[model samples]
Target: MKRVLFLFLLIGFISKAQVKPTIQKDDIVRIETTLASDKMEGRQIFTTGVDSASAFIEKEFSKVGLTYYKGLKNYRQEFVVRNASANNVIGILPGKSKPNEYVVFSSHYDHLGKEENGKDKVYNGANDDASGTTAVIALANYFKELNNNERTIIFVCFTGEEEGGFGSKFFSESINPDDVIAMFNIEMIGTESKWHKNSAYITGFEKSNFGTILQNNLKGSKFRFYEDPYLEENLFYRSDNATLAAYGVPAHTISTSKMDSEPNYHQLSDEVSTLDFDNMTEIIKAIAISSESIVNGKDTPTRVQKIR
Candidate 1:
């Protein structure tokens, strides 16, 4: 009788293990459309554009069925930045087992507000950060559908990253920091990489073991993970992840920006029409795949030790 029950449990485990993970094409399209849409006014911090973007993100999170942060009624984690009130859109997918241990995925949704030349002032920051924001939204959809994570997953869409990283800073201060185990901040992944095709780099690669673990997970996949070639760019400590990493978490920024030669980067021509959808799709999938182990509590990357 005992042997019969054991065999039944074993069969159930095998069946679950065979399930294949997938990302939706519609979700990808939504990302591009949301980023390219003119209603966002480039998602500038403290502006109506940012407010509209936040509403859109909250709606997406609601559709995914992700819960709000504890004790909060809505998805917005409101806070003040430099005397101006802003917020970080927050949602959580509670873990099946370890609810306290968290893995955070973040992207700053705010961008350069407007440009000088009156008529040419609308800065459609498609690649600067809209791409990253899209990636975060898409990732939330993918994971929520799977609904099998062992560690809690927190999706944060931050504001004020362009001004001074205030949104992330405010969030980092509000949290215990110890509950967070890892953080992956997606940034500007709309273009092809330099060295490896269909590959992306992790900023501050040498600071922690997270990058190495991510690469190992992608061994059989078409995408590859590489250390950022533009280390002099100081990208690691420049993004939203820097705040959490300072607290000794395994936090890093994932990006595909060619710092030295991105012709449209931060320019008027930085539009959705210029993005490579194929590469962007692959990048999102790669991130979803690489993070599976971490989300499942199977592989916990080492905590980052700050240089300064």
Candidate 2:
């Protein structure tokens, strides 16, 4: 009886240990507040907004104690695509054991710049991706606090997602694809989903085993993960994830976008006021937990098969 009781205690301890880090609500609020602030000008590509967003990310990286990729002096991974000056804000949270293999968490910070009317100038894409951007920042902080991952976690704030996914495209080519284990591209998760109130879907769900792994990891949680319903939207190829997915990585976008009927998507009214803070916090937590397996090198999501 004593031996059985000891075994039970050990299992309980392991279960508690597997629980992922929690992203603070205040942290999420501050990140979103700063990213969506008017001074950033909606983070438009090739504009002052983009520059301001980059600065914010750089500061956060420094604050989180993340290191620049080894052998590099700076955190900025500068690159260009299509004559447009773009960059990927790269920072590394080295693994405790396997410091080379990487699990990349990314979100594009760029949005539609100024509107044609020239009067209502701000195209504040709060939900389109600021939600995702803020979440990435929060995740970095959470992991930093945990301070224990077996696989390097690469946090990237991508630019030019709205302009042809050029930022990620450039980044995918720059890195050794073999070293990258998976890519979790957060996008448009500010709103509630059509399924469960706190549910979200992964783009290109059928193309890779990533979705299955994430869903199984999140079992018993209120959140439910599903295939992107707007497949007709060709959403798999629509976001930054597409760039890495094209390279045969298990790259997928996590989102709550109801593209077929979203009233605020890319519109002037897509402001921060419409977001559900509590729900957003829950979603962030869910992502944190779902990714715990990957972060620890305990589970390797299946790679995407090359599409002909």
Candidate 3:
């Protein structure tokens, strides 16, 4: 009875800013191309290429007018691993009505580096995460333009995901998970999902009501969200969201990568040419629209069972 009442009220409070915030496919292309370019050396951690990626992300955050996270001087949140340095780029758009609550959007920027002597030396991870990282930037731009969120929105591009979830682990430890209302950890949305275009799946969908709330908010749109179908692969435990999920936060990954049949899963062939920018743009729009209630502090998702 309480659940039904909450849904009814949530549906009633649909965003007054019905005009979709601008999220251009062209902008996505520009960022994706730059990140996947051969010059970035596939953005491997501890490489000059990784440093370049971090700088690029910081520039985009600045362009979007995002303020620094937690009073940091810049977006580069530095941390070390095995005596080598890797940094996550984070930007913030503080909320007005509910400043204490937090909503996070994130993706990993690290990937496998180039082959030493191969003809196609670069492992351009366009679809693997450039697409996801692009979505993070695009979303940040969108929300900042809207400028009406009630819960603080954080945008972060994590490093060392390929090496293991090093960046996310460091970040999760730095923040109190209880303050984080929800986390949207995007990955691999460049290709068509198993459900095809205009659709994406959420990892750890059943762990909390996050997916349900998202789907409910998207009811009027053509886009749809499905549960992660590759249960045997244990995808929920993989990627950047795992650490926070263990902390009982409602953190989930959104993706369209088909586990068994992804042709470019980890190949050097994961270039920008393979992505469908139109479809990717729609997915970003869907997320922005669906998350309106949460961002504005109108909806609160249940916590994940804390992993001990």
Best by TM-score: 3
TM-score of each model, paired residue for residue: 0.91, 0.90, 0.93
Q: Write the per-residue lDDT of candidate 3 for residues 25-139, one digit (tens) a residue.
A: 8999999999989989999999999899999999999999999888579999999998998899999999999998999999999999899997899999999899999999999
Between candidates 1 and 3, the one scoring higher on TM-score is: 3
Stretches of candidate 1 off by over 4 Å are 1-21, 116-119, 306-308
* Angstrom error at residue 5, model 3: 46
TM-score-wise, the better of 2 and 3 is 3
The sequence of per-residue lDDT tens digits that candidate 1 reaches over residues 178-222 is 789899999988888886468999998898899998999999888
What root-mean-square deviation over C-alphas does model 1 reach? 4.4
Order of quality (lDDT): 3, 1, 2
Over 12-112, each residue of candidate 2 has an lDDT whose tens digit, in order, gives 99987856567777888788878887788878888888899889988998999889975568877787667767677888899999988999999998898
**Each model's total of backbone clashes:** 0, 0, 0
User: How does residue 170 of candidate 1 score in lDDT?
Assistant: 87
**Which candidate would rank higher by TM-score, 1 or 2?**
1
